[model samples]
Target: MSEVPSPRLRISDQDRESALTALGEHMSVGRIDIDEFGERSAQVTAAKTRGELSGIFADLPEPHPLLDAPKVAVSEPEKPAWADIPPMQRIMGALLPILFIASIALIITTGVTWWFILVPIGISAVGEGIWGKGWDNAHKKLGKQRRRELDG
Candidate 1:
């Protein structure tokens, strides 16, 4: 079995700051995107604190390319609409149990059979799951449609 390399020494604050400064210089010279610079800077900073950043800097390219180019800003990725639905459905689905319990409490308070509440709750849960699944499938279909449109 091949032995894994032991972890390297933790990065110091000075090392992290220096790396960030270098990365900023790279970004300023258009060697790297703003998003890339920000991401790498954060990664280096976090890794320094957590002792994980050392391996990253070991194989350094001497005199990096960012020393000469003009700076450019990075464009953000567009957000998809379906990102909103899953969470909303999940929250509403979760609430179903609490609502069912409350309904049962109300029925008991009125001296009615608690069993009746089970039918509605069960039906609602099944319906919710089916609806959520259908919505997800629809989103997938839309994504496929968009991809086909783009490809064509």
Candidate 2:
């Protein structure tokens, strides 16, 4: 069985500060007037034990610091799966569209099947990203540095 805590337990400065803050909240909400706040603030300042501080909030409702629940911590939202990939892959992916546009433009202007050349090059570049290793360790390190520079 757990032992019951003594009312005579010494209160720390932090405990006194919390009680004072609670009293300030009570005063701010007009629950306690300025005169009563002064009295309560004095009591909080002179408090030496847990029992002494407890009486300061006896007549008040919620917002009692000692009795209040701890605040919950908020976690960061999840990042997309593709956020971790190196820049080379994204660049290669982007290259395909540009190549396609250029091929179309060339075909329209000169009308000589420019796509035959650009299409294979674009496919090979993008295919290397999908199937072949995009970069070695050194290149990956450089990509990370570049990402940091851009972000920072």
Candidate 3:
């Protein structure tokens, strides 16, 4: 399209140069890799007419004015491990272990029936912890082990 209307018209040096620059622009943004660029550049250099030069961009996306506008980078979504946990579940996961351990210490110091109440609460806490975070944590542990093996 950079050339004159005649398909058989002999391409000038400036036309070949322009085509090569466009190829570089496409490659810079990962539209094509180094091997494809080399092959296209070779074709561009060997092209004798306007038609031959046009063939190189046939399959590539058309470089319209809209496409030439500034691009916005799309970032990956956040992946916080705790994002899916309910507030009460998260609180239970954090508090149950500490309170259970403290209750054990209290029971040791004084033989009291009040400490018995912690038994069901301790079980509930453990269950909530497993439900809320167990799968993600297990996957992360497995991934780490696999990576360590691979790296070794």
Candidate 4:
């Protein structure tokens, strides 16, 4: 008669605890979904020791197989220089010329060369536009950084 292969032993307590800790860290950092975290935690808790934990993991398919596999890093699509500018900034930029014209008309109506006022108002509008663009760029960068860190 042919001999049968022996079944693998279950994990031991120490290993199971270690695995649970690692799974907890992953879950805390939002790497794994709630369901996956619960399932893995249950598996680890069920294991009595290290060997049993190893056996349990060995039987399961690789988690994030894609992470283990080689992959090309995809570059983000090129954003237009103006794309980083916020809608409000873009709208303000569009209105700058009109504002400048209105300011000149006001200066003429007042019989004062309030052209000086135009300079400060134009500068302020430009500053706001620049500030808005910077804010948008920072937000985009932060979002990308978070996604990279989370492997999402």
Number of the top candidate by TM-score? 2
TM-score, one value per model: 0.31, 0.46, 0.38, 0.27
> Ten consecutive residues with minimal summed lDDT in candidate 1?
62-71
lDDT (Cα, tens digit) per residue for candidate 4, span 21-117:
6666666777777898788788678755445555545644443111122344789985645566667755555555566787778787888775556
Ranked candidates (lDDT, high to low):
2, 3, 1, 4
Q: Which residue pairs collide, candidate 2?
A: none
Residue 137, candidate 1: alpha-carbon lDDT: 43
The RMSD of every model to the true structure, in order and in angstroms, is: 17.7, 8.1, 12.5, 13.2
lDDT of each: 0.59, 0.72, 0.69, 0.58
Each candidate structure's count of clashing pairs: 1, 0, 0, 13
What is candidate 1's lDDT per residue for 16-130, written digit by digit as tens? 6666777777677777788877777677767733235544444444332222233456888655544555565555555665777887887878877777688656757575576
| Stretches > 4 Å off in candidate 2 | 1-25, 33-55, 66-80, 117-152
Candidate 2's displacement at residue 3, Å, is 8.9
lDDT of 3 at 140: 52
